[model samples]
Target: MDSETTIREPRAADGGLDLSPVSRGRTPLLLRFTLFAIFFFPATMVIEPLGASGTVPTLLCLVLLLAWLASWLWGLHDPIPVRHPGRLAISLLLLASIASYAALYAGWTGGSTEMTRASADRWLLLLAASAALVLVTAEVIRTMADALQLVRALLAGAFFCCLVGVAQFVFRVNPMEWIQAAMPGFTYNGGDTPFQIRGSLMRVAGSTFHSIELGVVAAMLIPLSIWRSLTDPRGRRWFHWAQTALLVFAVTTTVSRSGILGLVVALLVFVPFLPRLVRRGLLLSAPFVVAGVFLIVPGFVGTIASALGADTSDPSIATRVNNYPRVVQLLDSHPILGSGPGNYTPPDALRILDNQYLGSLVTLGIVGLLATLAYFLLPGIAGVLAARAAVHPALRGLAGAVAAGALVAAVCSMTFDSLSFPVFALLYPALVGLAGGVWRMVRREADLRDDENAATARGAMMARAPAPTAKEVG
Candidate 1:
């Protein structure tokens, strides 16, 4: 049969394709993806930075990576190549890192074999994660419609985790009963250094490795809620409102100053777009937002203040500052490639600099640092431009806020930590894919516009031409 005829036939009725499962209430692709995001993302914050002997989190990462790969191999979806110039730039940076590592291994007499081995392992893990990032980019592009679903899922999951933490704090109990029921004998692996604020309220860490990590998670969700509230329908307004309030409560309870700053940045960046949405949304949500502040802010503020003022005796912050000069001295000695990839611990490697750029420079050298910066900055720029060019008004608004929020997170987090954190690592590639999809849509629209203009111009010319006469026909 001809292709058209074959398509017209009821192939599923002919037993060519199974439709029963689809006809039943099986989850749609978007919803399945959303559920996956919801289940998996919150747990990322809880993954032990100090490696667990067991493989739950590692195994989960592997599974996610495989799922991303399977999506591509099964012909379910294909992602366009990212258009950022930084991709090439960063690859070159990795090459430079390899070169630096070679030099360090050859020349650095100070390096210990065991220490070198550990650094090498970390580097290998980083490369493996980078490969997974490529898969995530492909999967996201393949399933752009599912992107918002995944984002909403993340928001819901973060809120739920926060709620659990809050409940633990209020009741002064280990809320690990549900956890134990879910994964019998699953010990909470990480150390707990609880934040002590003047207020007697117990700060809850939930399942996250640290209360600070939990705070960051809450901060990240606020922008998404604000975006949805402003752009989603009135019936959905309450959902966003409730979500925002919950997230704010979570952030306040965690009491990370960095988290507070991140939230403020998200809000300020989003407020300009609020007026563009239905006025009722902004007005309706405003009172709830204010009320949440009264309910949430004091505890968070006090906790943050205590952490900052706690002690000159504990020189973690001071040591980080003091150690920078020696790091800079090493950088000056080996400026081009630096000591090597994972070869930065000199005789006096005092503190792991709480700065991504500095840490990158020490290992990857100038080249790796440049590459890392490109990887981050390129996505943010693409996101902003794509949001500006989006055809759908709601998506444009949302993309803009997401872009802003990610940008703020990048800048703020760099002061306190590196991208080695699970959430940050996942978000970097995910945002890249989002920007890539929006850019693809933008280009498609431009192409369509050009074609439309050409057609219109041709029609105008035809209309202006005289009708053919009998002489012309002869």
Candidate 2:
């Protein structure tokens, strides 16, 4: 039958493809919940006090974990079939994290109370949840269209945060405080504050608990927005451009040097993947646009200079430099399985390590550090490889966007404890999962096409073959 005839064929009475309104275009309920959780991660902090001591993000993660497990156990009718990747690397990573947590718990000689240890255990749980997120997202996103939809959801969340951040920056107001006031026991501290001021400008945090968190989210969104703007049809391009503009403004208003650097790295990673003409246009216009920005916002230019350590007197840079040696010393003390997760920095120090690599080393030790690196790096590499393999332009573009987002996470990790922050922890792995899913979908389509082409070629050969001669038949 022709393709159109096959598609329109009615379902068999034995319960085949159902074209009814209830089934048509309907997303799985579990998948819907997972996407909602991912998009609203920032609001998790508001529900921190609702569930017995653990933060709301963790609780939500637990809910996701349960949902994923239940779906697996009950075989709840999934529309997209899941393809599992080789699990050796992921298994080893999880094993290392668990081993390190056990060692740390057993060798607890520090003055921290039982409550502290309990809280530290949650970090281990978060690690497991992150792994589960990768698996779940990989299964849910089954096509290039699905991947783009996921990106749009992420961008929408970031756009909302940007709007709130801009308002906070301009009006010197924080909506979180009002939410806290109206809702008893909802204590969230991430907002605009005097300490977030850089030079003469105040930084805005939006719904996240810190300006840096908002900055990181905006940085990650910038490249994705750019990719959408470049790849989308002319009719829809304006929406992506608007998202890109908002994300850029949000990043600048946060005054995060790391965020700015991360954006630069992301753009660098993304530009090569663009169509040649688009790439050339972007490269040509970038310098003029940058100059215009510097002229319009001199303060932002100064902040960038300071972030690059151009100002010898910038205390933040000096502070980070000074902390490196201290972090190294801590790592040396617990080199194998460092002091334990969340125990590297003492209350006396009055600051957590700003560097994620060092923080992992000091807390989880060498084994944990390696595992953490593998967890972050493997999926990112897979995404880039997938981008190279994709035959469809839309699939290739989505894969490139995923890789760019991963690059943002990588660059930002050097300057912040990215894994510890829910915004990065959740979004990064989810994007990686989405990339893997898209890759699988593309491969499946290619395989099916190849099969069809081979079948057609064989049929053509048979038709073109000469009939047996009468003598041969006799």
Candidate 3:
């Protein structure tokens, strides 16, 4: 295949990054796999094989990692990545986990002695694989058009998840049970409780392990759906808008505070970046949308409201508060690089902590906690700043949505041990990876514009130069 084949040709200033071998119309084979992986990973998150913690998506992640490695070595696409904003941050996170594990084995930590090397090793491999996903994704996205396509793919994936959740809500059936038939060894991956209730309403889990996980994932995708709707053609806008509505409805069904936190954070990050009229339209419609959902699911809004209003009386709230004393003791034993990440095993080991930050402090220690914050926050802040400077409407909207999604992950961390869940864990890192890739493309364009200006200035100088004298020939 000729490398010179251009599909949708990019403008000299802002389409293809120099390192990206992907042309505008062409989806590189790796990226094709990436998109497919994104689509099905959400749906596969519910099944654990052989009564152990595993999913098809987990195997897919390993496949993605190998594909990226093959691409890097075979030079079928970009021989090297031009930028690595996501990789740097993700690598820091992985390094922190390694340090915590090393500390545990060296007897420098206070975690359980019964903790096996295999568990810690699994955690490390997952982190490394997630980082590779970020690296390869950032390497492939070449233009605003590519970004928009990626957004559509992501929205479609979200739709699949939301649809499953909707089925549970409206039809009282779960299609995930069918997967169990194909893979006889597979079992439900969520908690002992398969479902939950709020008032008279049944909480929906979608393709995720728990209702809260589905809600948080829905919250993260809503901004991207809205951004896609705004940027799509007028005829196609309604389709995307309907997706946005579905995502919102899905989140409302969960009645999970974590999901609510993520949705609010997504909107807060997204709305300010929107054009004035668009922003105003969303703000004015907010109450009506709430009213509409409340009308559709009669007791849901009241259920969520009372859940939010719960003080010390809430068992969930009380559990989180009571865990602090134990966390403090663990932190005191190993102040810098606490016990160990993924070391929390029940019965003999520590139980799950509700807050990711507090959990990180107890498990990963101070350095690890900082790495967690940096991984979740830095790329998002950078994306928002990049969006402000972006000239293309497509690029601007994509950047803003990326920022909003990342912020949702960060904010939702305070509400749950988010990293413990597979889909959210994988999706959040993938968002960071996409941000890095987009950042590299944007930087490439800026550098090209600079070069063009420099060349133009040199040409002008040559054209303006005085005629050479005959004396120079002597």
Could you say which candidate leads in lDDT?
3
Can you write out model 2's per-residue Cα lDDT over 1-474, one digit (the tens) per residue? 221221322423333222221122223455444544543444434555332224545555667778778877787746245553413335556787667767766775252456647656667667666666667667766543445555656677677667778778778876555544655555553422422777767887776656787778777767778876765432356777877877877777778877788778778767766778878988898787677656645588777676666553666656667777787777666788777666654564335677788787887788878876766666667667777776555566667777777777777888877776666676776666666676676566566657768978999999999999999999
lDDT tens digits by residue: candidate 3, 1-474? 453344454555544343322334343555544544544544344444222235565566667778777876887766354665677788788889989999888877645475455567667766866876687667656655466556666677778778878888999887656654566545544452226887778998876768888899999988888877876542356778888999999899898898888888898888877888888999899999988998999888678889999997787888778778878887887879877877655452134587888878877889999999988888888888877876565566777888899889988888888887766877887788779866776676677777778989999999999978899756
lDDT tens string, model 1, 1-474? 221111222221233221111122221354334333432433323334433322243444455567766876997756344454324433554576667666666765235376664665556455444445434543343222334544555566565666677676677565544554566434454444334333455666654545666666667657667765654432357877777777777767766666677777766655554445444676687787766665655554455676657564545556667757966876776666666666655454347566667877777678777766776566556657767665555556656666666566566656555454444444445545545544555555555556767978999999999999999999
The C-alpha stretches of model 3 lying farther than 4 A from their native spots are 1-10, 13-25, 28-53, 74-81, 110-115, 184-194, 232-235, 346-351, 452-474
Clashing pairs in 2: 190-209, 338-365
Give the TM-scores of the predictions, in the order they appear.
0.74, 0.83, 0.86
Q: Under the 3 Å rule for N, CA and C atoms, how many clashes does model 2 have? A: 2
The C-alpha local distance difference test score for the whole of candidate 2 amounts to: 0.65
Report lDDT (Cα) of residue 463, candidate 2. Answer: 100
Among all candidates shown, the one with the greatest TM-score:
3
Q: After superposition, which runs of candidate 2 have C-alpha atoms over 4 Å from their true positions?
A: 1-53, 77-92, 108-113, 182-185, 189-195, 230-236, 295-298, 311-313, 348-351, 449-453, 456-467
Where does candidate 1 have its weakest 10-residue lDDT segment? 18-27
- Range of the 10 consecutive residues with the lowest summed lDDT in candidate 2: 17-26
Which 10 successive residues of model 3 have the least lDDT summed?
A: 44-53
